[model samples]
Target: MQIGFFAVGIGPSADPEIIALTARTAEQAGFHSLWAPEHVVLIDQYASRYPYSQDGKLPMSTKVDILDPFVALTFAAAHTKTIRLGTGICLVPERSPVVTAKEIASLDKLSGGRFDFGVGVGWLAEEFTAVGVPWERRAERTREYLKAMKLLWTEEEPQFTGEFCSFPKVRLYPKPVQKPHPPILFGGESTPALKRVAEVGDGWFGVNVTVEDAKAKIERIRSYAQAAGRDPGKFRFMVSPGLGLPVELDMIKRYRDAGVHQVALGAIPRDAKGIKGEIERLAEKLVVPAAKL
Candidate 1:
């Protein structure tokens, strides 16, 4: 089972030095990947309820200097060689897909084909409205935009036509280093999200699910994929069990038995000052021993 690190990478204490240090250490420690979520701008009043939290309140960390995922990942990419970078989940419907495809494909080219595009339809209604994107038709828009992005990445002279976007054949220089474009992992626990995974995604990324709960979800996902004539075994499972206890070996075994491909440690640092030390401690204590099993 592969292990990864999930970090917010914001706040007063998360300076460049700290981030660099963490990235270097995580690479040295043999962590599989590093993931960070994105929020271009946080909105206070949104009609949609925040899904992760019980109270529908966004975390205070969202209000911090949360660096843009691409820019920050580029900086980290310059600093590390082997450690892959991913958006734990990027809110795609809120941004222009053309712009996003260009940026991410460039990053993938620069990183030597080490990029995973994790996407979601977004939860903040006000953020979508602020960006002039309708929240109601986000799913349809997302599908169209992603299809357009694929055309841009794969076709020499790409063109796209859809309700949300249409473009004439155009050349995008420095096509992605990855052959078919970066692997996309769909994030969310909803039925539509599962269907999206079956149709378009390379993997299903689960959040806040225990091993037992995840097994059921994975089975459901596989059923959907099979129904769509997709090979269920081709779909990877990447889990981020947020705000949880230290991952035990037993938990790791459970996930492995249930066919989880990777697990990102979502236990966050309570003290930003000690984030590095905390991560090192967890890696040494939990991950190292489990890898041997």
Candidate 2:
């Protein structure tokens, strides 16, 4: 039963001082990890439905300044020692795999091997169009790009050939500090997403699932893994439960009972002092009690 916060570098906390303060405070308060969300650019008008909300619109404004997850987490890495850092969901089809691999390897090296790679195919069709990446067959492209990145991370003479990505034997220096690259946690709740978990994921990251949803999804993932000859026991389960806004211990107990390994919370405060106070409150209210659970 570990805990993490959704993001640090956005809105009022986007400043360098605030990012450092948030990271240091969370680590000191006994939080296990810090995560950051990513969106290359938000369109003022888009038709893509935000999966997490009821009105088919993200609750955020287009004016929100979302610092790049890598840059933000790098700030966190330099500021804190023990807190693990992650991209809550890096949209895979939007960037070149080579560039992404290098960034991830560098982050892992700098962070002392504490990086969790969370990835998703993406939901915003318009954003993909604006980024000049195809909106169709993106999941397939995501699968290919990730495998290509794997070759870059793990192979001595890395090479890959696929519909979306291919490279001749080459070298990438400072391969990830983790043995075989950082553990990739696949995000999304679609059937295809679960199948992606079966294909190459080290874990399934459920966004906004309930206790029952998490349980059912975990079982489905297990079955998918077994069907794919993957050992389900080795896969970690992380959930960003949609339960309590000010999360409750009892809600945590339910998720723990459902076999969730880590609970990543969201809607954290945006200002420096508010971030510190929230971490302190969460540490007192949930971190201490949940650790015992």
Considering every candidate listed, which one attains the maximal lDDT?
2
Q: Over the full model, what C-alpha lDDT does candidate 1 score relative to the true structure?
A: 0.81
Which candidate tops TM-score?
Answer: 2
RMSD, candidate 1, Å? 1.7
Model 1, runs deviating above 4 Å:
12-14, 266-273
lDDT of 2 by residue, 111-184 (tens): 99999999999989999998999999999999999989998999889888899888999999889999888999
Q: What does candidate 2 score on TM?
A: 0.98
lDDT value, residue 4 of candidate 2: 86
Give the worst 10-residue stretch by lDDT in candidate 2: 239-248
List lDDT for all candidates, in order: 0.81, 0.89
lDDT of model 2 at position 64:
89
Candidate 2, position 68, lDDT: 88
For candidate 1, write residues 1-293 as lDDT tens digits. 78888874556424576667667778888788887778878876666788888898886744677778887777777778988889878889988888999999889988888888989989888887777888898988888899999999998998887999988989886788887889899998999998999888899889888898789889988999999999998999988777555677788889888889888884445464576776778688766876776
C-alpha lDDT (0 to 100) for residue 159 of candidate 2:
83
